[model samples]
Target chain A: MIKRASAFLLLAAIAIAAMPSAALAAEDGELDAIHHSANAYYLDFTPIGKLQLPRIFVVQHEDGSYGLELFRSTAAAILEGGWVAEIDHDGEEHAEGEEGHAEDGAQEAHAGEGEAQETGKYAGITLAQLEGHLVPPGGGHVVLDMSISKHLVFAWLGMIVVAFIMVRMAGKYKRGVGRDTAPKGLFQNLFETLILFIRDDVARPNLGAKTEKYLPYLLTVFFFILTCNLLGLVPFGATATSNLMVTTVLASFTFLLTQFGGTKDYWMHILWPPGIPAFVKPILMPVELLGIFTKPIALAIRLFANLTAGHLIILSLIGLIFSFANMFGPTVGYAVAPVSIAFALFIYCLELLVSFIQAYVFTMLSALFIGMAVVEHHHDHDEAHGEHHAEPTASVA
Target chain B: MTLFAASLLAPDLGLIVWIGLTFLILLVLLRKFAWGPITSALSEREDKIRESMEQAEKALAEAKQLQADNDKARREAEAQAQSILREAREEAERMRGEEVNKTRDQIQHLQEAAQTEIEREKQSALDSLRQEVADLAVSAAEKILRENLDADRQKKIVKDFLSDLPKN
Candidate 1:
């Protein structure tokens, strides 16, 4: 049973990893799929088909009143709200915005909408890119789109999963299974170990005595990022961590926490290094301040890029098989499948490892940054520097 | 909305807000529902184990001290018993010597008394013999004077009397 399950798991992993490129091969992929598999507002259960999510928009009316619009699906939203697509005036001359459909493609989308008018979700509501915001093409200004996207939905699901696991684990611990005695189950043991790792290995070493204050954020980020990353690996799921907005928010939390938690010494060091010669302070000040901003940026990008790159490589590898088919023949495509799958499987495993590593990196860096901020530094100049660099000491570089 | 295709890296403001809210909510949730109990439990368990360990060490030290005291007491008792036994033996020897000396003195005293008594008896007997000899000599002298003088017999009696006298 175990063998079969494992084989099925391996096969399923390869297949899920390969599907994005396959879908793109059938229709050349968009810019979105390069980093992470993009999901439409529709949910795909694979065996079943698309499940169009409810569309919600808080719109600013032309008359200056606000309204909340809810539609069963995007098609319903367009049909009821009288929306259209924003087409570029010139041929292929467009600013950087949402995907620019070619003229023919635009018309097809219109036709699909016309056909879907009678039906339900054959088409979606038209959207136009206006200065990086997705506004209704000719509709009221969109103040906020609380619409559930692939990532948002997955994020909720991930949150739910984290909550359920943690809450249940909390219950067990509350009953004293963990506190009074040894933890009994695997999940209990695993979470305990991971939590302790974050506490002792990450938070304590970095944040020191004030570790308890920032530990919750560290743990939350870890579980949240880890959950999002793993959830994306599931069949028909998109990685929320692969999204820039998601990673940015996670990093910004650390950034805000670090800033707010900053001690006198932390701020002083950034604003003015103690031992540096007076003349060089201004020159080094910008560099020091830039380091602060760069830390979180690096944190955000590191997580986003790592997760996105995993899918990109996997999708490209799968794309290779089709490219070979086009180059040689069906025979070559047939021959390429095994090699493509083997490499995809290898990369899939690597991606799993990377997922955890990325989560760890994100959490660790956050703690370190917060540690750098909140850590109390002694007034004895060099000793102050030494204090921050004290425990779990390593070159931050 | 097929809107993500335009620019991949552009920040989704809606998502940013949603994630911000979601993450904050999650932080509160986990902190309240999960981490509060779990972390406290872990630390509580740690403290309990640490306390038990300290208690064990203290107990062991106490036991070793008790053992040392027991050994010392046992050693002292053994030494006391040895001294008592030696004292009893010494006392017995002294008593035996005293009794032997007393008995020897008593025997010596008894022998001296017996010797004195025998010497006195001998002297009295000798003195009595001397008196009897003197009376006999006087009486014999009277009888011989009264009966007529026989110088040879009288001389023989004197010689026999002198020969019979104890050596002075």
Candidate 2:
């Protein structure tokens, strides 16, 4: 066990060391320069431009305000794209000829500039500039640039291979081979226990008879989210889930499924609920309808916020080491690094639990909503009201 | 606020495409391979656990039954031993009574023999005494007659006495 742990630690160290630290330093320097530039003072916020993708730039203003700006790359690309963009703060389109002239001048001036100068122009880019420019951010700029792309790919592939091995291990157990009778591999045991837990604890209780129908989706979501979350915890890995776009996409699927699978009773309950007074129905109907949309929205925001916050916290802690390093020199920086890394690691472990928890919460809520929608709702009426008109002959008899 | 608004307006077409494709593939694969067997295995495991519990319960009951049977057999053996001792004691008492009856009969026979012998002895002694008394009486009578009368008187008394005696 010690040997395996040490090996993993060593690999992690190598992976961390392999990050494009020089490149990140260069980007940070460029961003700092842009923040202090004369143009930065004029702009509302200094935008962090795409280090690689020229068209995609994050604009930053004078007061450190930021937004995304996307310049059209290819005309065909614009037609295929569906993102909404507005020029500057106003929701108006810049005349085509006017926008073209501005973009051409900026591109020509910066075309021959070195990497440092280019970074300066593009530093502190915000979400608005990305939208305005019609350029989507690469989802991995926070950790490293192109230099560490290979390592990121390696990690992603490694996760896939791990997942495949786990599934194979589960398959071996399912073939009537008991734990002792079969090859007791580590992957097999872990995967088996996890699968059993999901089946018994999550799927069975929530989905019931139809659990089998939904198991695959639940397991996939669980493992995929878990893998992504754990990988983010790695020293140099980019947190995919931290990006709102990624989590938004995931939540949208659940939303769509819930909406499409909603039964008539689900609609009835939302539109005209039982038991409310006639006067209160109007007030409650809107609230009930809003709940239907808000549920999925909450699911999306909760996951995105939790994951992004974890990343920000870790980065801030690491930034502390750098800030202290400047004040106290390299010795203090190196000394503080281990402590920061330790805290980061502690948070990373917590993230692992959160990853599982979030996946469970998402799947469980989906099942509950689906279950509620699919099941029938029974309404009880007052028997006294019905019996009020009963025949008076009964009293005579 | 614009970023937030634009984000909401964003169609996310690429994301939707990728997600839909991935979800479809996952759904198919899971339905084909994962769900059925996993549920069955879980149910099977539950059944096995319950069955083992039942078997354990039955074994415990059997053990208790065997213990009770052994206790009953031990009790029966103890009872048999006590009855055998009682029979042996009764036989011993019966033998003792027979021995006592035999001794009593022997004592009675001895008493009868003793009584007969004493009676015979008593009769003999009486006969002897009577004979002696008779001899003494005759002698006394002769002496008295010889001293009191001459030879002819003595002869006349003797002849009278002899004739009286012959009549007794």
RMSD of each candidate? 7.1, 13.8
Candidate 2 docking band: incorrect
For candidate 1, state the interface root-mean-square deviation in angstroms to 1 decimal: 4.7
Tens-digit lDDT track of model 2 for B1-168 = 333334333444333444445545555665556555555665676687788899999999999999999999999999999999999999999999999999999999999999999999999999997997788577758665566668777777666666666453
Every candidate's DockQ is 0.26, 0.06
Error of 2 at B71 (Å): 2.0
How far residue A46's Cα lies from its native spot in candidate 2, in Å, is: 24
Question: Candidate 1: where is the Cα deviation over 4 Å?
Answer: A1-36, A85-139, A382-394, B1-6, B103-168
Residue A203 Cα positional deviation in candidate 2, in Å, after optimal superposition: 3.5
Give the Å error, residue A326, model 1.
3.1
Which candidate's TM-score is highest?
1
